[model samples]
Target: MAGEGFRSALEQADDRIVAGRAMDGDVAAFAVLVRRYTPMMRAYTQRMLNASADVDDIVQETFVTAWQRFSELDDPGKVKSWLMRIVSRKAVDRIRALRPVLDVDDIEQEAPAHSAPARVVEARAGIEALGAALQELPAAQRECWVLREMGGYSYEEIAEELEISVSTARGLLARARKFMIVRMEAWR
Candidate 1:
């Protein structure tokens, strides 16, 4: 338990150190930041985007933008949040630009690698149900819910990204959650 805590602390310290160095124009430090955050950014982007938007391309564009604006980041200790915000923005931009919704089949099916086949099947069914429920939401509500729930963003962050008021973000999230719960209840 102690070792796990120590390792987590070390990772946090390293993230802060690398972010500061990157802001100071250290290419090597910036590379370390990229390696550390790419997977997380990619995953976040994937969840934020519909099937029409290419997750890989959006994540790459996010990193490029981050490189250009590293010095603009206010808090080095919050590099993970910063990176996620970039991904969220990039994904939103793509969604707006493309204006295409993902077909139901395009939703990714995920299962725990070592799970039993029945468990995998059950997980996939749940994912499908959730995806269907999300699709029922208005775009704005869906975006707000995904950012707050899946991406772990605060209300202020969601409002800023979506260019809406904090109260609006909150309302949208509430409505979205209510709708999802009602829809999922029928599935059970």
Candidate 2:
């Protein structure tokens, strides 16, 4: 327990120091950043993209870009958001590159679960329904929602990343929320 606590503390150390070391060519520091943010990046990219195969590639590319441009990071404290922005951009690029295809992976049959609680089953169903509803949103609105809600980016950041005005980002998010609410109502 003590060792786990120590490891957690190390991982939670100041991002600025770690990022500074990474900028100065410390491979281990960069590894720390990767370990800290990879899970969130993977999750964000997975949500942004419909296809599962390309999520890993997009996340890997995000880190690669961050590494190449380490010196350009103005604020190391914002590394988490910076990494998320990179993942968002990469996921968008991948989506644009691939012709839109209806992803049936989300609709595929799931393996049987033994002795799962009713709440767990219901929660899983809700999540699946939400994912299906997200898939139905327009690409622009979907990206806005993922960046704002899942990526935890602000409206200004979303606007800058998506190359639109702040009001547009707000509108997109609003529409997405409304659509999701309506779609999810059927699940209740």
Candidate 3:
């Protein structure tokens, strides 16, 4: 009974949003929308991004983009999902833009030395192997795995972010994990 009531309330709210009263010019309605979704966006962005400094910037961009495109939004009930997609794309773009340009000399200098302590060498090798394996993954698979495992997003949330179906997201994550586990075991 309680679940039915909650579902009815949600349906009514979504109806109001779809009717355009919320997007037409009601600041309070928009505020309610933002308040409902922004925390999830922030958490998703932070998980995908290595740098904390840029999380706020990416989140702000996501919300601003959503607000500007609100009228274009096809389904008001999917607002949370749409906002998550925006944040995911923005985070990936920021990461690509900030990818470091590595010098060949620096790379060569970091190569493991035979004389290094066994544990130290092993740890470095593990990190390097993991990095290589991650680089081998398709971008979409990698992002899904990282968001689901590292960011702790639900399958529904990941599907929304990647603009894929929940089943597809599940398949991608399962494949990604299987590959990583196999590669890590081989490394060991």
Candidate 4:
């Protein structure tokens, strides 16, 4: 019975209904989209970005952009990937925009302090150290690492999202893994 209801909801929600409603200026339809995907987008952004207050702003911008261009979307079934692509682009743009003004030494010194129980604190410190080390990597490598490890995107998905070839994504992940292993070893 539950499965039937879920199927019925999905059947009723065919992209055409959502798109038509949105095109007719029904803001509620778009709001529904935001409500459905915001949590996943937030999780993905948090993993890719440094935890900062600006994350919510970035996410809001992503959805706003998505709404503006929603009509251009070729297939409604691809909405999740489309939204994710927007978020990834926004994240990359944010990183690039920061690069000109950011000092590498300052970033290293400003890494977040770990606050948790003894064991958890140690683990968090190690993770923060890893994140700091990752910040030193090439953007492509860092993105591949975060998508695979943090966002749980597969190689093909990461490649599609990053506009790289699958083999390239694999190579980048391999390099990122090797770099992380070396850095974590040194931290021990």
Candidate 5:
């Protein structure tokens, strides 16, 4: 009975309406919201985390948090962005958990096992350099940079997702870019 009319009606409803109903404790409405956002959330997580980062786990954890805290959403119309923000947070947490503790001097990047070309070696080095530089950025700056550069989000969209002002988002992105450029240049 819960899904009979609720799911059908929710299929055509806007995100905010579905969010409102979900906030009101309608499981069917929440399921609709989950279905609507899961694909995007998964893609976003993939961009944020690597193969070992458990993209599915992050996405699932995001939906679980969203379900538990849907009522805390200040703007129902921004449900998509809110879900994205949660995914980002979860992905970062997973990254932190997965980050292995290694001594700087002891770390030697081994060559690709399959006798890859020199270009592959250079590309791998560049990626490793970029990753190390990113680790140096402040967390917010890293978030803005990833959202803008990798996630293909506009400044305004990044601001909305990070809950920062546009100017602040721009500043963070700029700092991240500057730091990365210098770090990569050193690598080169």
Candidate 6:
């Protein structure tokens, strides 16, 4: 009845309106956003993290962080990417804690369920090749690569996280991309 209408209204609102309501402490509006985004956020975290990482925990943390920082969202229209940035930062923190022992094998888990056996095998090979190429990169370059490519962070954000200048971040990412392009040519 009335609840259904309210729910529909929330669902119909654009991101700016929803985000503004959430920022103004509308729990129902925030809940609508959570419902809309949790699945995609979960999937993104799973891809960004290792199998051992508790993706549910990371996703939950993302929402909590988002709620706490809702007031800081300068562009409400970008809330989706903003949520993803939180997920990226949280997932990276988990990765650092689990690093030096990461299992790249979980990459195979992201493959399509209906893929042919040959596709699976090829995907496995590609993952190994990418992992090896990543290993060959300088540590700084690799960090920049993951933060930019996988985390979807801007150069400025990546630079701030790495405590480097924007120029350095751009250089590192550029070199990393160039190296990956060269090393991964076999797959293409």
Name the best candidate (by lDDT): 6
Please give, for residues 1-188, the per-residue lDDT of candidate 4 as tens digits. Answer: 99678545644685666655665667766666777788998888888787756679889999989878978788776777888999989987887877778677676453344443676778978889987999988999999999999999999999999999999999999999899888889677
TM-score of each: 0.45, 0.48, 0.45, 0.45, 0.51, 0.52
Compared to the true structure, candidate 3 yields what TM-score?
0.45
Worst 10 residues of 5 by lDDT: 110-119
- Of candidates 3 and 1, the better by lDDT: 1
lDDT per residue for candidate 2 within 1-188, as digits (tens), equals 99678556657789988888788887777888989888888888888886579988888999999999988899988888888888998898888888666778767865556435876788888889888999999999999989988999999999999999999999999999899889989786
Model 6, range 1-188, lDDT digits (tens) per residue? 99999889999999999998899999999998999899999988888874545899999999999999998899888999999999999999998887677578755565566497888888999989999999999999999999998899999999899999999999999999999999999899
TM match of model 6 to true structure: 0.52
Q: Tell me how candidate 4 scores on lDDT.
A: 0.82
**In candidate 5, what are the lDDT values of residues 1-188, reduced to their tens digit?**
97577668888999889888888998888888888888888887788775555888888999899988987899988998899889898898888887898898897987765556876787788788888888999999999989998999999999999999999999999999988888778675
Residue 82 Cα positional deviation in candidate 4, in Å, after optimal superposition = 0.7
State which candidate, 1 or 6, has the greater TM-score: 6
CA lDDT of 158 in candidate 1? 100
Model 4 clash count equals 0
Residue-level lDDT for 117 in candidate 2: 81
Candidate 5 matches the true fold with a TM-score of 0.51
Clashes of each: 0, 0, 0, 0, 0, 0
After best superposition, candidate 1 residue 6: deviation in angstroms? 20
Give lDDT: candidate 5, residue 150. 93
